[model samples]
Target: MRTPARRTAAALAALLLCLAAAPATHAASPHRHRAATLDDLARQHGRYFGSAVDNPELADTAYSDLLGSEFGQTTPGNGMKWDATEPRRGVFDFTAGDEIVNYAHAKGLKVRGHTLLWHSQLPNWLTSGTWTADELRAILKSHITQVVKHNRGKVFAWDVANEIMNEDGTYRQSIFYKTLGPGYVADALRWARAADPNVKLYLNDYNVEGLGAKSDAYYALIKQLKAEGVPVDGFGMQAHLALQHGFPNDVRGNIRRFADLGVDVAVTELDIRMILPADETELAQQADWYGKMTSACLAVRRCVGITLWGYSDGHSWIPSTFPGEGAALPWDENLGHKPAYDAIRNALTAARS
Candidate 1:
């Protein structure tokens, strides 16, 4: 019997042969004539279409133009993270994040702060030094307050505490969790709310797009927070999908459960990846998944938006992290639209109708 990876490779090779004999045509032909931009179609259905961008990508003129034209919202991929904002303890910097916010304003795009608190990518000062519980709690409060205050009017939403739970519904034993316990989640949300009363505060995570142990944990936590009148406003599903793993089952149902908690839902950081050297079959499957994800979000009234991790394959983070697996975004390396782009547009158009 072939190993899973070997099986995947064999399947991919077979698909390539079939695609080589196929005629050229629009990948998502039925919806190609809908000239409306994603943002335009999304607006008709009381939603927004968005993409995440990093600071360095701004230097590319072509990338910038497409970002400005194609999406109505943008999230700074790393600019607002703890390490980026406060490289040194007690010293805060918003220069990088500010650039993205300013660009968003110029383009008439809404901004979603990538994150305010997370376990990874923390500064050396905080992670290296030992701190008493009191000291760590004070430091955490100050960071959230200062960062959120600085971006108050600029960012409309924030991932207040990200990836706080493991796949088995247990909390990750991060420094914050080790120090402050699970109460830190609620405290972080409270601090953010105090800093920016108008901004929507969200708990974001990957692998929680479907009904599973991880998502169930969030459901319980969200319910508890709501009962306590905490200012939690949303849950962000970072739908980073892989073709071999299959799409999340009942994604609409999962999103609806969160919406039932009286908090909005969003497809944050969505990217569908397949093994490299993608062929027509893999691309078609990817396009179908994109449409399904968009349709899932649209099925729920409180699902506010969908944000691609990045809009194009050229600058995606997948190849570096996953190795040998990429071609994840809606655009190819040359800034040209892929089949997934039309699939998303088609879904949005159908939602409007």
Candidate 2:
């Protein structure tokens, strides 16, 4: 016969096994229970889910497959920029950009033209050459007109100007600003509109997800642009967040204010990074922030979409740019979904409900 202690131990083991076999709550398995893709969930609320991708990442079968399957929209990370589109002054090359456009089309994904103008990554010829205001204006017009015209129908939106304002609400001393003054902003938008009237034009920037000097500057600028019929359609908030900096306190309010200005807003280039060696607490906090951002966008009708800078940590630009800081995406380096992924799905589901 078995002893009383042995009998009690057997009963406890059986109870533990029963608990392990039971289904987890929604809180525990947010992504596991959901069968709908993110795009599908967003569509119910009339929003698009997207990610930015570099040209090289397309070569990875697994990476590309997940990108094509999960997201409904894609932005070319570097292919459509001034440097890649026109490596030589007046000599345009669309090979890299075209590759991405074709891939997006084949996958039935909408494309967002990544940036017609920026201070950095200009071709050496343009940077090296010294030109008068008139010469630069003509070149700028040509570049914007041709680039937009070439990708006319393929792209639904364009980041016409990016990072043009500093944190103090002053224009950066870029060549375009120095040579042509702030008139370049209006000229760029008008030129793009004239080239393709259907494409939505946007001014994109980083660190403007909340009320601040930088975003306030954009509010005034966009208001003036709209009043003067400059064809401004949207503002892109590049939410390149970091854990240490803490989440923006007024992301939803910020987006609402821009939408009230009679233009759409997009959470573009979003990635939440933490310091090296991410732990469970940091990852859980990351998930909460991701859900908050998604809910913020969904709360605003004019907030059209949200796009991750890159979908996976393996290809994220964080490690290279911010050393000792990585794991900034919803997917791990091995393409497995991270907690942020479930958080996003749950957020979308909650929004739809």
Candidate 3:
């Protein structure tokens, strides 16, 4: 294919693809004339717009109904995590995860499995036990295989491993990391792939939405994983923005760099949080930031989607997590559209033109 004769053929094919990719940016469906939802607008540009949901929020019919209608996909905030899935060794509980997956399906929303492995919120059994490397590896493998196989066709993607790196570009010393060494990340991905060959496996993390030590570490690791024929499908940038930290530097460029590594990039777990009692000015700034983040994802071909941590501030975890900060979503506590919501909509809608 690299021969001189094939070069011209390849160029022609590239041109044809470019032509096909443009001109009709939006998807054509029967409901095209109706007011575009965020998901509908994103679908036009070949991407999904989603939000994360917790099981307790499902009990709030008003919230759940709106969530089901507005978004194209959902990630269970805590439902699919290791703590919730496997409480005891070889004992699995899927009640929480099943509820969300079933709800998403019933509402015509796709599910991105929150995570198969993470450093935090792990069950006591896993953390409290002292096991040999062989024992721990077996434990991890069984958990991933069972979880992925159980939800095989239900989820489109998995955060196969989450928050595996520290801020200084070093691997986080999680139980898996401590027991199985750095190879654990790749192993988890392989196990997930073996169980659910069709689901996209990803490395999900926060603080990687921009060019920094943290994002750089992922860039290198993903490049190495691909070079070694690992089954990584995407990189999840938990775009948990804070107004105090300023917008991530050259986010479109950051997304592009990961795309170059032959892995799709996603704005997974996006939220723009602000100080308590947000005002008109802070709200407007947050809106602009949201618009920029949306536009950045739309610009990258391999950037598959964006998923908010939660849709409304009413259910946000910011207040509890960060003492003085709250109001981190596009929707207010009363399910009212904040300025950020319209900004996101405008960006997604503009992508079609």
TM-score versus the correct structure, for each prediction: 0.90, 0.90, 0.90
RMSD of 2: 10.6
lDDT per residue (tens digit) for residues 1-353 in model 3 = 35697888999999999998886655766467767789989999999999999999999999999999899999999998888999888899999999999999999999999889988989999899999999999999999999999999999999999999999999998888888999998999899989988999999999888899999999999999999999999999999999999998689999999999889999999999999789999999999999999999999999999999999999999999999999999999999999999999999878888
lDDT of 1 at 294: 97
lDDT of 3 at 274: 91
Superposed by TM-score, candidate 2 places the C-alpha of residue 63 at a distance from the truth, in angstroms, of 0.2
Alpha-carbon runs more than 4 Å astray in model 3: 1-33
- Per-residue alpha-carbon lDDT of candidate 1 for residues 266-334, written as tens digits (9 for 90 to 100): 999999999988999999999999999999999999999999999999999999999999999999999
lDDT of 2 at 84: 97
Superposition TM-score, candidate 2 onto the true structure = 0.90
CA displacement after TM-score superposition, residue 188 of candidate 2 (Å): 0.2
Q: Against the unseen true structure, what C-alpha lDDT does each candidate score?
A: 0.94, 0.95, 0.94
Q: Candidate 1, 340: how far from true, in Å?
A: 0.5
Among these predicted structures, which one has the highest lDDT? Answer: 2
Better of 1 and 3 by lDDT: 1
